[model samples]
Target: MAPHPPQSRPSTGPDPSAIDTSRRPFVLIWEVTQACDLACDHCRADAHPARHPDELTTSEGKHLLDQAREFGPGQLVVLSGGDPLTRPDLVELIEYGTSRGLRMTLTPSGTSSLTPETVHRLSDAGVTRLAVSLDGATPDTHDTFRGESGSFEQTVRAARAARDAGLPVQINTTVCAQTVDELPALRDLVDELGAVLWSVFFLVPIGRGRVLEPITPDRAETVMQWLSEVSDDAPFGVKTTEAPFYRRVAIQHRRDANETPTDDDIGRRLGITAGDGFAFVSHTGELYPSGFLPESAGTVRDGGLVERYRESELFQSLRDRDALRGKCGACEFRHVCGGSRSRAYAHTGDPLASDPLCAYVPDGYSGPLPEGRVSGD
Candidate 1:
């Protein structure tokens, strides 16, 4: 008479549209090679000269492209590497991505001068844009960070070459404690180079960067303030993603002043966030949910790209609240910020832990937040 009824469980089967939904991935990053010429201090890609089978061949790359195309039209593909330019087959790979309705882009170290012939090939291959990494304002600082002499010269040359080739060029700099004091010079450099946009990302402590503390709270604020001031007079538009609150306010201020300038307009118009507009594929063909996250969802060689991502628990978890831990649940800015999963894992040694970087934000800033608590688990 006291026997209890059986408990029931809810269905958790996969949704058919989960892979092909347009609302999900707006862009994808394919790391064709981890073989790089220069060794940067803060690089998380671990891109040193090493013998690894992660580099994709022409057929393999095309197979990945075919899988990516299943996400539907207008998805952007970023061809990255330890240095993507080092690959001789880069042009053909870019062509393959573009031919599949993926707008192709690349991120290069700028260690070697991009040959005019190569630039022409890239143009013919339909490479839409190129982003060159520039971590410091002056030659001494910039070249030093890259761990090579004369890198600044080569980078500047490459930037000019990309621009002259009719490919839009964007400069990406990491705002660390070392470079925090040089915001003005950085802006000037952007202007001098005729860059389309200046993207400043916070230095995430991961990989080789784990040993160093990037910046303190006070220093981060100082850098933010300086960037705000410099961007006011900048001819080229400035945009930042990692530093969300400060950059959001800065962009709004400029927009309110009737400034029509914008960065990643295609992404903006499409309502794509930094992570959504891009997915980083490792050299071994394992597709990550985003560039920085360590969780490998699946490999491109597994099968059709769309089917693999669809079956990925890690990929799905990225967009789902159940996958988050601790403060991310209640974070006020969870939607806009999405928080940095990779950053959380690296700093605290917990993938689901709250981002330690939040400690840098000032106390009085008004904004939405995700879960404001953290866990050691």
Candidate 2:
């Protein structure tokens, strides 16, 4: 593990982190395929049983990886999918990205395809991490959520295999009304599985995810507070997806605890929401600010990936927090904890609108509050 070369950040105004979104993104997720073995209840992809006929060819995928490398050395290239294993050339793609000096990560669905051999092959191919979803502590709850029996057992086995293969594992959990109560249990499992990180994803209503119930703002605040506590004691790091307000809650908690925050405070508090420091390329080359956000800024078929991210009007608007509406625009923490752009789009049609999942209301606000905003004066 040689230390990664420092990213050549041009300027640091999102200063505490020194990650300049204008030049390159911190993460670029490419949905390699929309094909999957299970129909999970909260799947943002609404995946199908087979890959699309118009999916990017292997050469096209390599080209996309090359474009992603322009972000600079150590750029994270996540090969996400409905199930990347469904593709025959997954290892080939992984090896290509590794050769480009990009830190490649894979998020394959839990299934028979995630065999020990496959895990080892991916590790040998230079995958930086293996992210697997485990929504429940018990088999019944997890299998049901995945809409497939035996998925729970399979997922656990794959995680252990990843660990055995000497690859770092990241446990991903879906947090919503259905699974919120299981957070404490999930944390134990994350530790048992030797995961280095627990990525808690709060559900945004979309695709197959629309049917799942979102947690109310007040409840969300409580969960984040608990998570902040969990982060302090848990051996593995905890981070929220689609819930940037967790950073606000964590920061507040630190102050209340009389703890001095680190310069990399916003590192795990990554909220570089859609089109800001995050970008997603769908299986068909459609470019989105996030996998949870369906709005297309441009297609890879039309122009360069980096060009679209830096120049598109949609990306430009999303990156501009001053142009935000409601509490998000007025909040002093807008630069670092600008709220979840994907959640905002899920609530209101406008991506620039306020994220409804956050309980915080800036003082002296006089605009229409988000639907289901915490009840208070």
Q: Which candidate is the best by TM-score?
A: 2
The alpha-carbon deviation from the true structure for residue 314 of candidate 1, after best TM-score superposition, in angstroms, is 1.8
The superposed Cα distance between candidate 2 and the true structure at residue 82, in angstroms, equals 0.3
Model 2: per-residue Cα lDDT over 207-290, one tens digit each: 999999988888999999999888888888888888888887888877642344443243452457788888999999999999
What are the per-residue Cα lDDT tens digits for candidate 1 across 1-377?
54222122111212322433334465677888888878888777878776366577778878888877777665667787788887877777777777677777788776754655555567667777778878877789999888988888878887888788766888988877777667678778888888988888787776667655577644565566666766667777676645544533444444552344333121232223333444677888777765667676666775646654555665555555445565554544444444556677666665555555554332343343323422321
TM-score, candidate 1, is: 0.79
What's the count of clashing pairs in each model shown?
15, 0
Which window of 10 residues has the lowest lDDT sum in candidate 2? Answer: 7-16
Q: Against the true structure, candidate 2 has what lDDT? A: 0.84
